[model samples]
Target chain A: MTRHMSESDSDRSPDAAGRSWHDMGGLPAGGINPAEHDFALWEKRVDALQVLCATKGLYTVDGLRRALEEMGPQAFESMTYYERWISAVTKNLLETGVFTTEELNARMEAVAARGATYGDASIEGASPEGET
Target chain B: MTSLPHVDPPAFPPPYPSAAPRFAPGDAVRVATGHAPGHIRTPWYLRGRVGRVERICGDFANPEELAFHRSGLPPRALYRVRFTMKEIWGERAERGEDTLDAEIFEHWLEAAEG
Candidate 1:
């Protein structure tokens, strides 16, 4: 492999001089446990939204990545993976005028008034006759 | 991912006619070492490093432009760049002989003498 692709004057600037937080390739990190956990219902919804939006051309994956990357390293440390993704997706949607911030705020308020837990807050959580 | 809304992935954009491919197979090229601070696909480690053009990976819309809601039309030619671990990692390489390849756009590359 080396023979086919010869090396040049590898003025290879070492990593971390001006690199961004998201570009973590070739960097030292912790060992991977290769664990697989079941995705939460909200995480599944976020994933589904990501796929649907991207497929529907509502926003490109690059747009979502830009949102994710621009959110800075602090957000990465604070938020879960899916949480950050949904945040990015929502940002992209809002930036594109898919819906107004006021609309989102109102909808959020409505959702919160339903219940505390995720399953309980969902519409299906309510009985057919509106019983909890 | 696309700039236009409601269009499916299959309808994003076809490979633009390159007319003539710039870097052919086995050509030594270097990834441009520029950081514009926007959505970039080129990894930082590979920037400014020399590599061989393994194969032309066809042309597609530039992600950097598409991310900003711009029509990345007149798609750029994409190539599969190959680099040795030694070339990228220097003395810190686990296996100097091992090579890794990445699909990079033409605008991110320039011709180099091997």
Candidate 2:
């Protein structure tokens, strides 16, 4: 597997002094590059899969793979049970001086509430299926 | 020396001995036993890792038995295992915070050092 540089490494480039920016493909230096960010995203999704598998009693390998595939990376990051992964990802962002924990938590809470509303609506819509 | 009355060898104990003491929440364990072929719940990546027990999930009824296959075996117990992020991902994990959890079968557990 090809190893990518960490966020810190991306910020500083040995090739350029004073220039401060280096481009390897489309990704730039300074903030979390797309590749590193993507890895973090994938890791968070996997962590969420682990949490879901554990909580739902879906421990089997096949169950985990299916859950991961279904949850997708974005959905996994937003899941309430996988909040720890969200916190960790947010903490990483915070250490980079990107966002405060309180702010991130608030944003997550809002997103979760919206998701719950949507889920409830979907359940209500499906209620008529078996009602004879 | 003449042998006394010949006695049959003590019947070999059951091939897969029942899990010693069902796993419970808060137990520290490592995966130590299993031998089923094909896809399994416990991946090889997590085989020897140690983690804290988060919950004692109930017995696991074999999925195969429900689909018209043989049906004499009892369900296996399940446990939720929590591992530190560092243990699973090493330096890849962020510093300070450390933990992740996975559901595992009781057969996967062995005593882990504190």
Q: Over the stretch A1-132, how does candidate 1's per-residue lDDT look in tens digits?
A: 342233322323234445778888876688877888977767878899899988988889889989998998899779999999989999999988889999999999998887877543454554688753
Give the docking tier of candidate 1: acceptable
Q: Which candidate is the best by lDDT?
A: 1
Candidate 2 lDDT over B1-114, as tens digits, reads 100111122234323434543654566677653434333456443545567777665566553332222341587766667776444433455741455667777666887765
lDDT against the true structure, per candidate, is: 0.76, 0.48
CA RMSD of each candidate after superposition:
8.6, 19.9
Deviation from truth (RMSD, Å), model 2: 19.9
lDDT tens per residue, model 2, A4-105: 224323322344232211112223435754553223343555576556644553233333333333344465446644454434334334544456778877
lDDT of 2 at B3: 9
